[model samples]
Target chain A: AQTVTQSQPEMSVQEAETVTLSCTYDTSESNYYLFWYKQPPSRQMILVIRQEAYKQQNATENRFSVNFQKAAKSFSLKISDSQLGDTAMYFCAFMTHVGGSARQLTFGSGTQLTVLP
Target chain B: GAGVSQSPSNKVTEKGKDVELRCDPISGHTALYWYRQRLGQGLEFLIYFQGNSAPDKSGLPSDRFSAERTGESVSTLTIQRTQQEDSAVYLCASSLNRGSLNTGELFFGEGSRLTVL
Candidate 1:
């Protein structure tokens, strides 16, 4: 079994500033995928970014980027030029192949991010 | 639909009552997932469906929770004799299954919030 951890329960950032949410996971498998998802007040879970275990380069999507440290088992999300729209609960997830064809995602506890104006 | 859709965005029911939540995955998606998100908590995997394969019920918390997917399209999650602990946001997601290695990023629905009183 795999588990993900988010040390921060809540975070706040000012508009136009940058903030980073930390995530770590415990997995014995060498091949896997990591993801960050954002859920807003409207209850929609939106994909933020993704990182593959074999890839050395991190993933970046516009203002959202990730610092994936494979050896240390850390994958943190960085939000730049934060806006009010970024205020939401962010979750880090870990996925790996199971039973040949099954794929399961294990998620960490979320971090509530509030981007203040 | 252009995106994953979940019905009964908000459901309020008393304890001991049965509740059903529906999910319609993205067109052509071969994989569908169910997750539970309690208030101020992270997402927890509930079940998974891939094509016509037997669904993965390993993540289900108990026998009270059950889910079914017809073909590769709509899915319904049912909670029998729900408890107060059953009150949470039920999220549905879908993704393209490329192979055993890459399941691709999941696209999520707005989720169905169940409030048990």
Candidate 2:
């Protein structure tokens, strides 16, 4: 069983600043996928960024990026030029590679991020 | 038609009552997922359905929680004899297909908030 851990329970960043949310996972499988999801107060879960374990290059999406260290089992999300709208509950998730009955995701406890203006 | 849609945006029921939450996945999406998010908690995997195949219900908390998907379209999660612990936001997500080592992005619904009184 794979478990994702988000050590930071809450994080705050001033507008236009940068913040990183920590995440780590326990998985024996070398092939997997990691994702960061944001859930706003409206309760809509939105994808922030994703990284494939096979790819050593980190993934970037606009202001969101992930530092994926497969060896360390750490995948942290960095948000640059943070805006107030970025305030939400961020979650780290892990899933096995494509074709399998175990395509379900394992999520971390989550980190509440507040971008203060 | 545009994205995943969940019904009963808010549900309030008494303990021991049965409640059903509905999810309409995105058109043409072959994979659907159900998750539970308790207040101040991360998303917890409940089940996953791929097309018409038997769903992976390993994440279901207990036999009391059951889900059904018809024609790989809409899915219904039923909680029999609900308990206070069942109160949470039930989220539904859909992806293009079963995620292998390489998975596609997951589009999520706004979620159905259930409150057991």
Candidate 3:
């Protein structure tokens, strides 16, 4: 079974600063995908970033990026230039293909991020 | 709809009452997912549907929880004799298809908050 872990329960950052949310996973599958999702006060689960295990290159989307260390089973999300809008609950999830079909996302507990002005 | 839509955004019912939550996936999406998120927690995958066929229902907590989807459109999750532990935000997400290993990203709805007293 795959499991995701987010050690930080809460995080805070000042506007224009950077914040990094840590995530780790336990999976035996060599081919898999990792993701970070942000849920705002509106309760909409928005995809923040994604990383494919086969690729060594870290995925970056604008100010959001991920450091995926396959050997360590660590996939951490870095949010640079944090804005007030970044205040939300962030979750780290893992996905893998099983018998040519991808399985459902396994998520970590989550990290509550608050951006202070 | 422009995005995944979930009905009864907020539901409050007494324990032992049955509740039905609805989710309308984005048109053309062949894969739909249901997740449960307790307050301040991460997403718990409940079920996954690929074109009306559920290949993964392993995340469902108990027998009281069941879900069904019609053709590639709306999906309904029925909770029989709801318990207080079922009080959480039920989130619905959809993707083009789970078979697309490289480019599929789950688009989520606002979620339906269920509270059982």
- Report the C-alpha lDDT of model 3 over B35-74, residue by residue, as the tens digit: 9989877888999999989989998999999999997899
Residue B71, candidate 3: Cα error in Å is 1.6
Candidate 2: Cα lDDT at A59:
98
How does chain A of every candidate compare to the true chain A by TM-score?
0.95, 0.96, 0.97
**Interface DockQ of each model:** 0.64, 0.62, 0.70
- For model 1, fnat equals 0.69
Off by over 4 Å in 1: A98-102, B100-103
Model 1: per-residue lDDT, tens digit, A6-103? 99999999999999999999999988889999989998888899987989999999999999999999999999999999999999999885444437
Q: Which tens-of-lDDT digit does each residue in A1-117 have in candidate 2? A: 899999999999999999999999999987788999998898888888988788999999999998988889999999999999999999999988644544888899999999999
DockQ of 3: 0.70
DockQ order, best first, reads 3, 1, 2
Q: Which pairs, if any, clash in model 1?
A: none
Give the TM-score comparing model 1 with the true structure, all chains together: 0.94
Residues A53-100 of candidate 3 have per-residue lDDT tens digits of 899999999999989899999999999999999999999999986555
Query: Better model by lDDT, 1 or 3?
Result: 3
lDDT for every model? 0.90, 0.89, 0.91
- Report residue B88 deviation for candidate 1 (angstroms): 0.9
Ranking by TM-score: 3, 2, 1
TM-scores for every candidate against the unseen true structure: 0.94, 0.95, 0.96
